[model samples]
Target chain A: MTLIETILSVGFVAQALRVTVPYALAALGGTLAERAGVVSLALEGMLLFGAFTATLGSALGGPALGALCGIVGGLLVAAVYELIVVRWRADQVVCAIAINLLVLGLTRTLLVLVWGSASSSPRVPGLGSTGTWAFVAAAAVLALALSELVRRTPWGLRLRAAGERPDALASLGVDVERVRWGAVLASGALAGLGGAWLALDVGGFSDAMSSGRGYIALAAVVSGKWRPLGATAACLLFGVAGALELNLQAEATSLPRELVQMLPYVVTLIAVSSVARGARAPSALGQPLG
Target chain B: MSWDRGDSGASASSSHGGAWTALYVTLVALLVALLAASLLVIAFDESPARVFALVVAHTLGEPYGAGQALFRATTLVFTGLSVALAHRAGLFNVGAEGQLVAGSFACAALGAALPAGTPAVLALPAVLLAAAAAGGAVGAIPGVLRARFGAHEVITTIMLNFVVSGAVLFVARTWLFAPETIHTRAVVPGATIPALGLGGSAVSWAAVLALACALGVTWLLTRSRFGFELRAVGQNPDAARAGGVNVGRMTVIAMAAAGALAGLAGSGTVLGYKHYFEKGLGADAGFTGIAVALLARGNPLAVLPAALLFALLAEGGLAAGARVPREIVDVMLAVIVIVLAVAAAETRRVRASAGDGA
Candidate 1:
């Protein structure tokens, strides 16, 4: 096949789409939380926990239950985050970092306890091809739904208010804390789903399998200017990069694998820096509510 | 608003009080972290008190353990100072990890190139300087981006980390790859730091250097004019710029300085301990430094004790790995950082309310 034909192959597109799913889902979730003014460096930890719980639940029950368990795991971490950031009013970034560390240790400990190894879990049932397609469609629907929710709905208005003008929102008798808590919880659930998609697709969990996808998702959130559709597009763009990298790895490229591996991160850095000037975060994004 | 001699005395006393308060809060946070860690131990079906005793004995009671703790603290001290220095300039330097890798790579590359019988005075300084310069250059990328493009330092630094990690691996494979192992060739004998005579421990002169650097950083931050400007920018950039301080220049300098410190950390691992550049060395130290700095409340002098505490925990974790997972130490570190963050915020809230009341 010609180079162009190879590049445009149906298999390549499918693979790219597959890669895009988790990023799109996680970025959308990040958008929800950041829109409500919560910084989420813990997305990595949340993703790992979700994957671990999903694997464990799959082993115990089935894929459906595994996904549900993943959401719960994410929610548990999110609750701790809320307690620290919203209730105690800690520095959001520091709290997020702490959460990431805590979850990492917790997941590793649990993995060793249950699986008898810290590396990878035993094979479990996964969402088959049909479920994968369903998830992709659901992600697309979520992107559109969230975009509408943020732009057209009153709840969206309140969430934006909680992020940008918490005092004003509080003065209007809307509980800013409640709005933020809801957003954070929903965000966790979505991120958990994304992570579950990763594990179920692979039929098992590996140590550090999420592997900085959470940070990349955050980059997408920034590059997309905190908009749902924009973030999804950014995720697709990264997914394409990832797919290209994989393609290159298969071919006999003279470039070292390490340099090729760096392509996505370099692209992310450039994209984030370029779009940073155009993007404006919420006015009170990282501030504790007074 | 008054700039009088009498006000200077009052201000000094107030600052002292603030330091004391930070110390007290940090102690309380440590206590809370230990309590949480104890609960984790209980969940593991072990007696928390017994585990705690074992950890303490393994970390501090034995001479070899004490030396290992000090060795670990030597590296943490540099990275902790790196984070603390950047924090003073209002920059969250998440790239310390990358900078450290760059430094270690530089040290290994340069030390390997040195002639076998070169003098220690010449070879040692060359490798150290090379590492610091490389790390500073890597660090300056995010600094420049932030200063010139208004890019958020946090994002840029984090992105740079992956880039650095990948680049380091590529370079190590292409230029410094050892045929049999995943690490580079050992440094020349002149380049290797001599171990301190500490009961067969791997402790080296890096510990002394770390302490000296800590003292140096404390003086630089507290007594120097540059430090005053850096702190001003951290407190309020607009005010600092309005007062004729070059905020942009200071940002770049602070980041570079922070990166250089992290590079020194890499040097401690390579020159003082490993004597060769390995792929995974000094990776976790960079992240752990954040916890150390937070616990220290960004005080350079306080970093020593904070790093020592973390080092003890790390050593203790390894020693007690059979009974309790070493990851529990990481949980404790995270808990401490979170508690300190909350405590710091609470103090700020109280101070603000008091100002309003006044």
Candidate 2:
């Protein structure tokens, strides 16, 4: 099949839609966090924890229970992240990496302790078609909602002020830290839901299964210019790239598979470098209050 | 754009005899990590004390264990220094993993191309230099991109890692890799660094090279005019530019130097130990190096002790696998980083407040 035809095929389109769920959700969450000036590097760890807990929760009950547990898992990681980055004023980049590493190690340890296997959990009841479709709709809706929230809401104004001008917010008798704290927890919950959906789609959790999706989501946020709907759209574009990669790997004998695997990241690099030229980050992003 | 660069060692080394305070903070951080991990151990119905004993006995009490830890530490020292230099230049380089692999590939490619009868004196330096150059080239791509195009180094460096991974795999499969293995052919004897690991261990003279590099980086960052410019840019780019420093040039040079240090990590595993390039050899060294650099607080000279500590923990993690999950060591590493960051920030706050009082 020609490249266009292959991308337009029902299977390809469906796969793209399916894969885009995690990226979109995470990207939206990242948009929210970055818009509030938090680095949100721990989004990766939050996703992993959400996946593991969702799988574990599924084993205990059903998809609904698992979904709740996933959000809790994400919140737990966020709380720790906020404590370090906000309360203690630790370096955001370092703290984010630490959170990711801790999750990687902690999950593997938990897997060994619980399942007696370090590779994967025994197959549990996944969210299946219904849950996935529901998440897809939810991601789209949340993106729109986030846009509105940032545009019209008083709390959202506080969030923007906190990121762009902390001193201004402080002078207005508002707590900048409190606004940032709210934004981070909210982002964590969104990212956790994204992770839970990932696990539910597969019916189980595997070691480091989130792989580099969290980073990819971060790229989406940057390329999307930290806007909710824009980031979600970027996620969809990446999802299409991923789908095309898989299609090419299956049909094209001349193209190397390794080259195909690098498609999304290469695309992200191009997009990010282009976007960064004129884009401005939140003024307070990654800076501790003086 | 704002970061601390983890300068715990700065105040300590500068004045008021803060070295002891820095040491105390590190010890306390380690203690905190141990205490937290011990709680997890008890939750899992294991003996923290026994696990600790196993870790000590395996990594320090036996020559084999010591040699293995040293082998790991050799690579980490190189990578830790890489991260440290980048941090000192106000850049967070996440591409050391790719840089090391690129170096290994170059080292192996040159070794395979050399005549089998080539002399050691000619082959060794050629192979080593090739490795460094390849790594530096990889490192420079991100630097150039950031300097000229306004791309963020953090994202671009990471993306380069994937690009490098794909390119390396393609090249290896076509002309380099041995049949059915993800490794390249062994280098000719002339190109191989002599091994010196104790107790049948895999370490080589790479340990000595790592130590030399540490001292060299320290000198470069402290004594050289170029180093002064780099640090000035790191502290405040606008002020440095006003002072006539080329911030862009410093950024590129610093990144290349960082890549070269990480790239030299191949000297330990590929040149000295395996005598060939292998996939997965470069994995985690960069990340673990980040942990080491943070613990060292970006002090190049202190990377030795920090890398050794991590290497010991790595070996100990495996040794304790009989009674507990070995992955706990990674958790410990993360905890150490987080705690160290908080401690460094706290110290800075205290100093800032005290200065205000003065």
Candidate 3:
């Protein structure tokens, strides 16, 4: 309420950065797929499966091994989605929803059968154990590198062309499916990293840890016009909103946390509506490639 | 989007028979998966035979279990109809969860505020109408925004789901919550639907009402003039606009109607089953509606059976207990939906090829 109190709130803002790290990572992944002409709605399930695998791997193996397992798990799931939607020309949206549902069941089943727990795993080696800020720094650097790669690389141009006009890309002798496949795989990997960060970096696995962050990442991807740097900025803004809400709740602040919590979603929607208007999405974002 | 089913070996006069075959195959495949899943449980040093038997005995083998299944189906019917209706207008109504929750809040508030002296006939419709208005308004927001600004409906609807959930949760805690319990005060008896006592379980006439609503929507879509226009707009908006159909108006109307269906679901929860609104009551209603609509291929009549099947699986999953693991139902549902999506995609491709040839 006072100037000093408002200045002290900066600490909570810093705290929110911790929450934003995973979201930024996930949104970055979504940005890749969307840029490549695929609406990867399976991010939610991919995140969940990745988290479960990472938790299981760390519980059985080490945290490093768990992270690798998560990446592999994400790739495997993405492969299935790509095969059905891209290769077989299935409805991409429904395929993504199916992946979400299938993984929800499979992951919950795995939790009960393997870990004998419903929501979480035993505390294993975690990113927090190494250093809390380490994961955040790594993510930011990855975001910057990927952003540059997307804008500068020949491969990025081909990927963009594939999304823009697969038929035209095919006419130019570029295998559109192959390019899209690579993008899908990359998207999965990034989402997996986000999931691993949530489970290993943040805390042990929790059933709803991903919550709707995967969906929010979709919002971020749209709001950012499928650009990596733009998405990173959007994710940070959302993260700050989340951080503010948590801190408000913590200090028993009289202001309604729910209303504050609504801010991120509202902002994301507005950002998406504004950004998506002029910016062209992947011409065939939701369409299955023949 | 009519299918000939000519690829099947059925005669022209018997083409309707091919539909029956597809339906049968889908059901059989689902059952086989359930069987295989249950067998896996047995392989895990558990008694597969016992678990399978228990699931059947509990879900289908008992009278009470069937009643509960119907109750679950009643809620899903509204959601299924909601999604199906939107699909008919080529709109994805992903905000059903939010609309449902909003409806629940309104139903709760109205149910609480109404006097005990009001007649049941007058009060029941009032509560339902309040819910429909609330839910329909929520559904219309994305539709109206999209119509006016060309803003994408999918993202806005999804975002709204969270907003509605959070808003309702806040309302529940601050305004509608009873002094004692965390939930809202009980609705006046006049506002509640009378439940039928069957096999020691209370069966809400809501199922009958749901059936009537489903039938009403089906007839409206297939037989009514507006239904023809909505379908035309759904199939090809540009073409529909060329033909004098107001694409934007149809989108809003269809979405609003869909929202009313979902709202009815929430109202049913308060008026038929629970007397008060609770958090997490929606769980996965909106998401599940996607699967339901896909399974039905946007056919309102087909949605009834599709929703019923899903409801049975959900209810049966719980009754099946530790052996089946409730998640198994989700697995079956996911597979079924994916299969349907693939089928629909294939159908579209084949139709496109035919058009090209023409």
lDDT of each structure? Answer: 0.84, 0.86, 0.77
Error of 2 at B285 (Å): 0.5
lDDT of 2 by residue, B39-77 (tens): 878868988998898899999999999999999999999
* Position B63, candidate 3: lDDT: 78
- Which structure among the candidates has the greatest lDDT? 2
By TM-score, the best candidate is 2
lDDT of each residue in B1-358, candidate 1, tens digit only: 0011121222222335566786787788778878987888887788988888898888778889999998999989999999888887888878889999999999999999899999999999899899889889888888888887777787788778889989998989887878968899999999988888676677799888889999999899889999898888777788889999998899899999999999888776799888999888886888899888877767788799999999998999887788878888888888888877777667667766987999
**What TM-score, over all chains together, does every model reach?**
0.95, 0.96, 0.92
| CA-only RMSD, every prediction | 3.6, 2.0, 3.8
Q: Which lDDT value does model 3 have at B181?
A: 73
lDDT (10s digit) by residue, model 2, range A213-283? 88889989988888888898899999999888878888898999888999988988888888887778888
lDDT of 1 at B142: 89
- Provide the lowest-lDDT 10-residue window in model 2 chain B: B1-10
Q: Per-residue lDDT tens digits of candidate 3, residues B131-162?
A: 98999999998888677766677778888998
Error of 1 at B58 (Å): 1.3
Candidate 2 clash pair list: none
For model 1, the stretches where C-alpha displacement exceeds 4 angstroms are: A1-4, B1-15, B18-20
Where does candidate 2 stray beyond 4 Å?
Answer: B1-17
